[model samples]
Target: MTTPMNNKNSLLVELFVEELPPKALKKLGDAFANEIFGTLRKLDYLEAASAKTTFASPRRLGVHITHVREVCPDIAVRTRLLPLQVAFGPDGEPSPSLLKRLEKEGATLAQTTRAFEQDKEFVFLEKVAAGRSLRDGLEAALHVAIENLPIPKVMSYQLESGCELPGWSSVSFVRPAHGLVALHGDTVVPIEALGLQAGRETHGHRFEAAVDPVVLRDANSYALQLQDEGAVIASFEARRAEIARQLAAAAVKVGGGSVPIHDDALLDEVTALVERPNVLVCSFEREFLEVPQECLILTMKANQKYFPLLDAQARLTNKFLVVSNISPDDASAVIEGNERVVRPRLADAKFFFDQDRRKSLASRVESLGKVVYHNKLGTQGERVQRVMHIARGIAEKLGDAKVAAQATQAAQLAKADLVTDMVGEFPELQGTMGRYYALHDGLDAAVADAIEDHYKPRFAGDELPRNNVGLVVALADKLETLVGMFGIGNLPTGDRDPFALRRHALGVIRMLIEKDLALGLDALLQDAAAQFSAIAGFDSSKATVELRDFILDRLAGSLREQGASAQEVDAVLAPFPQRLGEVPKLLAAVRAFAALPAAAALAAANKRIGNILKKAPEADAHVSELLLKEPAEKALHAAMAEVVPAANAQFDAGDYTASLQTLAALREPVDAFFDGVMVNAEQADLRLNRLGLLMSLHAAMNRVAQLERLAV
Candidate 1:
């Protein structure tokens, strides 16, 4: 250790441990570095322009920080003591209580002063507190950083027999830490953590390091030294980029426009597993290509962490790429070893695929009765029956008998694959395997496609179903989940949606709005709820209402995400439009109408008319031509006669944009009516007629959306 100084210098810290979980390494590395940096900054040990670079590897987590201070500046503090009356006697002299407090605090009466706190006087002590040195500050920061790491699960182990606490030798951490390094400039900071003392040495690349213990000269030389002597890439991002570059180059060397399957999650996990990456090309027997590319690709990527190459037509090739942690003079042995390891995995996939086809999906439907889907919602067989009924109803509403029959068949076989061997080995291939098996059974191509696509739009931005049969089945499947879950009162609260109810609701909304389905949302939900009526004491009314609100909420959010303004969304959605498929048209019409020159005045008048009609609850939209008394009312009635008819016709024809624009023509006459006429007239007949006329104008202006919601 060197003598303490106040000069700014770079800092380096490392925690060497056993292999961390590959999936969680990135998050763990970031959290560890950020926690330390935040604590130091809060303690005033960081300069204004301090920066941090994170390092994560299979065996270590480290950080390099710039412009860190060795010691913080002393701070001035004013501490509140007892009340004035309690701190002193009536003689106006120092009391025994005040003397004891001052002595304990290492202060005298000279440092005491009076201050008012909440209308009561109290004695305050003014003093300057000493700042923390780098060694002390770093120790505290390390303890805090370790305590806050987002470890998926922790392991507890007994430390060596000679730890700091003799007989109390248990140490618990994400992994048992072996070494701790803390450096400031050229000096060791002398901090300790996890039963280890700070040092200027760290090991690198367990198998390929040029030096067993790489000695550090200073904080800035850490990365270069580790690379030159240790044969490791310390930075996570740099290593991932290098791996990606190598993968692309190797793919090109195959000379068939081949490219590695791109997956960020796979890349991240592979990066976490390797300290020094070496990409090599390998191949398997051509006979395995008979299996679906999805099964083969998933097996290679999920089990072996390999990248399956795709040909120019985006078909999986027999060859794949492997990222090995070691590199030797002859890479043939490494390549051959990877090929040997992957062949058995591919064989297993092929075996499962071949065995699953021996029995038809229809024959396996009864097995679903024994497999429980949810305790309250019965088994998989029961759920399939519900989905089949819902799908047939939706198809019938679409007015195509052939489509209704195909959808019913598709829904019946959809959940049958849940009991298949292929799906049991890999749960992600549930719907995918169903489609292949359906095709094998000589089902219609449309029905086969629907068997796979009922689970489409599985996540945000995912594609919708491919055909009409698929769309009908998808809608039925999602509605079954929403109605069943909400009816059982298993609602999502805050951020904990264990059942993925939010995603299901969004899927239903997307199908209705994007596919332009003509079914009313209320009726579809009612049909879904009816399937649950056989259960004892089930109430479909409350669940239907709540489920409708949930779907509408999801629709409003989806519209906003698609670039609709909040005010526009509110205007269209406030009326609770049951035909969700018409929302986009209504929103478009509202947007177009809002852009007109007379739109502002008309919207303001509509809002005023609504408020007036609210007070006169007896008002109706029946206007009487014989009872027009004022010129403004007569002029408004005349404008309605010419424009309202065209607007009503355009609206009925589904030309919503033209209809709203046609209503814009009433703005001039409507403004004159509101400015000159009193809707609440003295005579009962005149007041009722005037209210009726205003009500008619209000009705004509707000057919597409609630124009008053757009009012500023």
Candidate 2:
């Protein structure tokens, strides 16, 4: 017998699209990658190493895979057939008369073999399926994956001259599939399905050479050749590194140690927009620096996809760097072209800034009513009123009346920028524009900062509210969103979170936990739910619970992301309506208790306690001191008496670990009582008494968590 050796190797795949929008490019790449993984898994290709790398410029969307397995594993296929009795007459064998009739009619076998499953008792046939060559499998898989790749929009193109005018019109792709290069090892696999012939050829820059094709020996050689031939670097990290290096050098030349590269999104867009990126330094009028630095940077980044340079003082400099995909013979022309494009954008930004500065923040209040928030939610003005009320409630909870009042004022004016011409043109400038406009309009710095920071931590890993007023507004804003949508029964279903209520709830949870504010969610949700009463067809009570559960789910997910186990998350969350921030403290306690040597034993004891109490008829009975017969039961009772106060103290102090430690002291006595005594004794009163003692034990542990749900 020969043993088979496992082949552990990577797979490489690349998709060449005509062009893709940068915003949609990442998602498309991710989807394709996910689909490939899912499809391969379904096909029983578990050992195949795969990764999808996507690259997009104006002309092409390229995806490269690495570490893909050569072939799916060999599988034992089986087919089941109908039992012999069903195929023949009931004479204990095939009947001669029936056989003669079947022979005359040319009847075939009554049953045939199908695929294998464990549920079948018998199989008629079984075969060992040999794995195909990596090249063959990859070709087949790639053809299917490419044709099925979901693109929001698709285009078609004409094909080479063939009899009957080659069916390009019948083909569809995200963009017209201009060309495809499918290489297996060193050989090109002909793709006959898509009307493409596999060739050891690929093109460089479209303008650099009209049709220069290179043969690739493998993936590594192919990547190198593509870069050497004026093709843009296909790797995202490589392009980012090149951009960073060029930006650094430009900063040094401008006598600044570094420049502020503010927009990560713009950087990603620029990186995707180019194949061969060349960094160029361009100077603008120094007077432009007088404009708010944010406005200038936003204009440059949003319009031109340029990186702004700053001096050592961290102030904006007159210099900016632009990344150009094409290498220019006269670089000055490119610089001149970029400067011309940036001028009008900067002029418009300055005009908006100047115009916005003239209006007072207080005066902008009336304008907020003109901006619609949501169709059913009335205007921004109404939402602000809700937020103001919520903020005041939050402030009262925080014991900060002054900041609460400040938050109220801030919330009322927060949406004022929505009515501004500047924010209307630049939607991204909503909170930011408010802050800038507020500062210019001579509002208090705290109020202006609150207006801006209320939208903090907008995405994962983003910063949360820094100021008290900001925190109040953030809570109020999120609460209103959750309450309003949930009241109307427009809850998020699976991936369809149209209102972004999940994000809002998650943000609220993060803000509260991060700020360590001990405000109760129940009261807050109740207040928020109350506001929607006047609205038609609202269910306030159900909405309140749904909103809390939503926040709690996010909290659990966030904790799990921080390396907490699912069991631990459930154990911590088992107690409903607890302080949201205290969840981590509770989990830490549970984990600490779990770590102790006696923790498992204590958990076992608690489990037994719960089980006994569940079977008992009534839990109202108390064990009398006179009824205690066994020394173990007496010892357990004494231990519970001593541990209860200490456990309660630890729980109150938020020292869950200490509480669990205190509870663990009862484990030995609990074990002894269970081992020595029968919980369901013949004497009804005695059994009832034993059950009551166990109920008492449960009561002490339930102060922290329901132990039954935490079962191992």
Best-matching candidate per TM-score: 1
Model 2 superposed RMSD (Cα): 6.2
Q: What C-alpha lDDT values do all the predictions have?
A: 0.91, 0.72
Segments in model 2 whose C-alpha atoms lie over 4 Å from true places: 1-17, 24-139, 148-150, 160-169, 182-189, 210-237, 260-264, 611-618, 621-635, 672-695
Cα lDDT tens digits for candidate 2, 1-712: 0111122243334555565776566556656556555565566544445444554445544444455455667877544444444435567565564455445544433523433357543324445578655556655666666666667777765554561225543565676555666554454555444555555566667655334765555554555666776465766657766877877887787774767575678777877677778889887888777677877887788877899887777788878999988886889999999988898888887788778778877788887788788777788788888888988988988898789789998998888888777787788878888887788877788889889888876888888877888888988988888899888888889899977877888888887777778888888899988777777788886678877787888888888999998887887787774577777777788888778888777777777777777777676448887878889989988888899889999888878778888887887888899889888888877888888888888888877766555668
Residues 514-630 of candidate 1 have per-residue lDDT tens digits of 888889988999999999998665668656998899889888888898899999999998888988889999999999988999888888888898899999998888878889989
Error of 1 at 456 (Å): 0.1
Clashing pairs in 2: 10-67, 10-68, 11-67, 11-68, 49-67, 79-114, 232-275, 232-276
Compute the lDDT of residue 449 as modeled in candidate 2. Answer: 87
Model 2 reaches what TM-score against the true structure?
0.82
For candidate 2, give the lDDT of residue 471: 83
Tell me the spans in candidate 1 whose CA falls farther than 4 Å from its real position.
1-8, 81-126, 165-168, 595-601, 668-675
